[model samples]
Each structure stands twice: as structure tokens, then as C-alpha cells.
Target: MLSAEEIHEIEAEAQHYPTREAVLIDALRIVQSHRGWVSDDALRDLAEFLHMTEADLDGVASFYNLIYRKPVGRHVIHLCDSISCWIEGYAGVRRALAARLGVDFGETTKDGRFTFLPIVCLGCCDRAPAMLVDGELHVHLTPDNIAGALEKYA
Candidate 1:
């Protein structure tokens, strides 16, 4: 069930938009900020509040990469898979993370410390081979520095 606080926050955000649908993304974000990820129940409740169908809201959630449908670990690591990142040693970074965390993309660590996922880009081609750990971008990564970079989050 959506909390009265969650509903109130969503309604408050909706006030800035012309329509409820316009607030859909922010509504999902609001829920995610509080709950970590948007579950099926939360999605349905949010959809009903916004007068949108569950399927419709689910579509919106699935379309956005940042909106995690399943539960994620405490930290989410978004490895860039863009052309620049791939060119600039993305393989080593991927391997390092897979080895260090013992989890592949879309999987969470056994200790529930981190979740690995691939992102198309972080808009930092200049700083290629980059990744975001809990929304903090780390750039210019190499195999050698990758472990140290992750340590900050650990």
C-alpha cells in the first residue's frame, strides 16, 4: 500500500504539472527515493492514484533504465557500455567488477552490498570507461584503478 506520506508527496509533485500523467516519472521517482525500487504493488497503487492503468505505468517504468523494477542492493553500479567506454578498456573494468563482486550484470552481490547493471552512457565520453556507484560517477577507469574506485563505495 502507498503510504499517506507517499500519496501526499506525489500529490504535491503533481501540483507542478498540468496533468497527473505528467507527474508519472516524478511519482515513480518519489516512490523509489523512499522505497529503493518500485514493486508491482507500488506501481499499481501509483497508477490508480494517477488514473493510469497498471500496464501503462509499468510500461513507463520499464522504459526508463533508472527505475528498477526488482529489488537492488544497497549500491547500484552502472557500468557504461557505450562506444567510447568500450573503446577505452570497458572490458577490463567489467571483468574487474565481475571478479570483485562475484556477480554479473543484473545480479546483486551475495552479501547484498552491490548490484551490477549496464548503462548506455553517463554522458562523459571524455572520461571513458566510467561507472556510477550509487549515483556517483567515477571516470577514466582502468583495470588497475577499478578496485580502488569501488573501495570508496565499500
Candidate 2:
């Protein structure tokens, strides 16, 4: 069941849209903000609250990369893999992060501190080889500075 606070927030967001279904993405974000990730049960409850089908809600959730369906670590790392990032040495950064965190893309650290994932682009082509740690953009990254960049999160 959606909490009172969650419902209240969702309702407030719904007012900005023409229909409840239009608030689907915001609803998912609101729930995820409170719960960390959206589970099957939560999706079902949210769908019901929005008068939508589970399949519909799940489709939106799956299509959006930011909407985590499974449990994630305390911090999520999104590394850009666009052509610009690749040209700017994304491979080295990926290797450094994997070696440092001991987890590949789509995997979370054993201690559940970080989850690493690849994004198509962060839209900062000029500052390639960038990553977002818990939504904070870190641009102009190199293999050497990854440790320092990650240190501030924990």
C-alpha cells in the first residue's frame, strides 16, 4: 500500500498533469525516493492507486533507466558510454571503477555501497569520460581520480 505521504505527494504531482496516467513517471520517482527502488509489490500498489495496469506501469518503469526495479546499493554510479566518452577513455575509467569497486556494470558492490551502470550519454560531450554518482555529475574523469571522486559519497 502507498503510504499517506506518498499518496499525498503523488496526488500533488497528479494535479500538474491532465490525467493520473500522465503522472506515471513522477509517481514512480516519488515511490522510489521513499523506498530506494520499486519492487513488484510496490508497482502493483502504485498501478492500482493510479487506476492503471501493472503491465503498463512496469513497461514505463523498465523503459526508464533511472527507475530501479530491484534493490540498489546506497549509492548508484552511472557511467557514460557514448561515443564522446569512449573517445575520452571510458574504457580506462570503467576498468578502474570495476577494479576499485570489484563489480561490473549492472552489479552492486558486495558491501552494498555502490551499484555501477552504464548510461548512453550524460549530454556533456565536451566534458567526456563523465559519471554521475548519486545524481551528482563528475566530469573530466580519469582513472587516477576515480577513487577521489567516489570517496566523497560515503
Q: What's the TM-score of each model vs. the native?
A: 0.93, 0.96
Cα lDDT of model 1 by residue, 4-113, tens digit: 88989988988998877999999999999889899998898898888889999999999999999999998999999999999999998899889989999999999889
TM-score between model 2 and native: 0.96
Candidate 1 Cα outliers beyond 4 Å, as residue runs: none
Of candidate 2, the 10-residue stretch with the lowest lDDT total is 11-20
What lDDT score is found at residue 106 in candidate 1? 98
Top TM-score hit: 2
**For every candidate structure, what is the RMSD over all alpha carbons to the true structure, in angstroms?**
1.4, 0.9
- Model 2 agreement with the true structure over 34-112: per-residue lDDT tens digits: 9999999999999899889999999999999899999999999999999999999999999999999999999999999
Note the residue pairs that clash in candidate 2: none
